[model samples]
Target: MRNQGSLRSTLHQRGMRMTPQRQLVLDAVRELGHATPEQVCKRVQGTAATVNITTVYRSLDLLEQLGLVRHTHLGHGAPTYSADEHEHVHLVCHHCGAIDEVPCELLDGLADLLAEQRGFALDASHLGLSGTCRNCRENPTAV
Candidate 1:
């Protein structure tokens, strides 16, 4: 679990002030581990002051720049946001579009292997590993 207060303080450390919109956005991100901008805006604006999509985008961009938040395009066009700063990898559910993060040193070794085999340094930061999640497995689609 992520500490909201500490995560808020990280904004101060980044020399950024927290407005209601930013806080709301951050809270929504913390609530929904990896959410796209639209999802974030909908949740943050729920029962709160009206917030535009641009606000979500700007906040996410600033957070990502400040290392207070992590995001990945994941070939989905829309970016997903995470508030946890600790290095981790992501598993994206292709069926339901859910995202989960887990810390794995083995992923780092795979990065090393890629570098050695292909001379390609990988940015495995919040890597997107696409597959069906457990939920999807349990509730397999009627194909």
Candidate 2:
């Protein structure tokens, strides 16, 4: 889990002013990890509240710019926004499209291989990982 102060510091850096809409979007993102802009708006609307789709998208872009969020196409569409910033791999359920994250050790090997074989400098934090989640593993026929 990330500390609230860290998130506040990041918002402070960008001089992002607080808004009820943005706060609702942020809360939705924190609750539902790896979601699309449409998904975010839907989640926020679930509490008998309303926010424009444009507002949701704008907030996501702002968050990404501030490095407070990261995105990947783990599910579908352009990319999914996630509040967690840890360098981990995403495991997506093929059946339900559910997403889960796990620590990634792949970068260590890739880094070593690049240095030893190709002599290249690469940062693998931007890499995206995708696979089946545990539920899919247990229910193969669901997909």
Candidate 3:
């Protein structure tokens, strides 16, 4: 979860008008943790009861552009969003379609190696490593 107080100040510093709709959308995203725009819309409507899907999408786009939100394509579905705090990557389960966070530092050596050898500075933060989770590995047919 994000610090609401700091988020508000960040929005103000970014010159964004802190409207009730935007606030509601931000609250929904924060509360939902990793949520899609549709999920955010549903959450916002739970309280505001008047916000539309378009408003949620616009809010998400603006928030992402302002570096307040980060969206990741976990698997084959819509991208999931979370508060943008630091560099991180997603560990996606291929069988069960689960997503987990892995610190970007874990791949720092690989990033450096790629840069040195292939001249590619990999952006691990925006990448998802797909593999089988422990549970899925143990029960291969469960999926």
**Per-candidate alpha-carbon RMSD to the true structure:** 3.7, 3.7, 2.2
Stretches of candidate 2 above 4 Å error? 1-15, 93-98, 115-126, 130-142
lDDT per residue (tens digit) for residues 1-143 in model 3: 45667667878897866778877877777777788889999999988888999999898988888777878887778787877764588898888888788898899999999999999989787788999899999988888
In model 2, residue pairs whose N, Cα or C atoms come closer than 3 Å (at least 3 residues apart or on different chains), thus clashing, are none
Candidate maximizing lDDT: 3
Task: Go through the candidates in order and give each one's C-alpha lDDT.
Answer: 0.77, 0.71, 0.82
Flag the better candidate by lDDT, 1 or 3: 3
lDDT of 1 at 35: 78
**For each candidate, what TM-score against the reference?**
0.71, 0.69, 0.84
Model 2 lDDT per residue over 74-105, tens place:
64466777775555776666667776665666
Query: What is the alpha-carbon lDDT for the whole of candidate 3?
Result: 0.82
Q: Compared to the true structure, candidate 1 yields what TM-score?
A: 0.71
Which rank order by TM-score, best down to worst?
3, 1, 2
Model 1 agreement with the true structure over 34-142: per-residue lDDT tens digits: 7789999999889465799998899888867766678876556787787755466778788887778777665888889989999988877767788888988998973
Q: Rank the candidates by lDDT, best first.
A: 3, 1, 2
Model 3 spans with C-alpha error above 4 angstroms = 1-15
